[model samples]
Target: MSLEIRIAASTDAEAACNVLRRSIRECCELDHKNDPAILDAWLGNKTPQMVANWFSSPTNFSLVAVSEGVVVGVALLTGAGKLALCYLLPEARGQGAGKALLARMEEQACSWGVKALQLHSTATGKDFFAQRGYTDAGMVRSPYGVETVFYWKQLDEDTTCPNAPKRKRFCNCNSD
Candidate 1:
């Protein structure tokens, strides 16, 4: 199914939270695994109420992908040019929704004069970001103890860094 991407509304908070929670539980095993602590910490802040708060943030811009009026994906960008969140339901994976979501969010950020963009890529998303031109900024230990890579890209210039150590494991989510 194709997705229509658009700026998210406060009304979309609930559905967006659903997509975020499900994607984390069903699609992020490679990164969070069966660790209850990690999962809890990662999932804790993504409740619908928190999503609404995200929408209310003046410096945070968000987008949602809808298919037949149901939200299936979400991407959030902060005023600091951080790609704060990017997720899609497992079924929506590989349908180009992920790419479209990121592209639209990136376009919006660029239009806002964002010169650079950065995100912390879980082991599950390093290659996905790498393939889309993000550079490795090294490993960061999350509060949950997950060691993930920080990725950054210069939107105003062509700068690439591909020679970082490969993640020890791969994710099914990134496969075709």
Candidate 2:
């Protein structure tokens, strides 16, 4: 089935949060042997209030991929050009939904006049980001005892959307 991409609304908070939680769990399980308590702490810290704050924040932008009315993937962009909370359901992986969601987020960042984008990618997603022109910046150890690789991509000047405003600081709308 073809995936549909759209801007995420406040209504998507629960599904988006679920997707992120699952993604983190799956990725960590595949790569690490961390205890349940650490995993719970890392993913459990986000609450409904935080999700609401993300939706209301001006500096944050979120996008989702839906299939048959169900959200299968999500991505969030922050004012600092950081990409966060990017995830695709286990069933949705390897079917282009992830790439589509990422493209849209990059487009949004470009529209916001962001010069660069950064993210910390899991072992599973590291190659995916590298294939899309992101370079490794460093490695970060998670509180849950997992090590993630940091990556960054500098967008070309010509890729900036003409309609985006020139602003230094904006709202922080990151998820996860």
Candidate models: Cα lDDT each = 0.85, 0.80
Q: In model 1, which runs have C-alpha deviations exceeding 4 angstroms? A: 157-176
Model 1 whole-model lDDT (C-alpha atoms): 0.85
Q: After superposition, how far is residue 140 of candidate 1 from its true place, in Å?
A: 0.6
| Per-residue accuracy of model 2 over 1-176 as CA lDDT, tens digit each | 76899988888888877777777777657545567776776677555557656866888998889998888988889999999768888888898998898888888888877889999888889999999899998999866667889999987654434455545667699867
Displacement of residue 169 (Cα, Å) in model 1 is 45
Q: What is candidate 2's local distance difference test score?
A: 0.80
Tens-place lDDT digits, model 1, residues 2-110: 5799988999999999999999889889888879999999998998999999988999999999987789899999988899899999888888888998887777667
TM-score of each: 0.86, 0.84
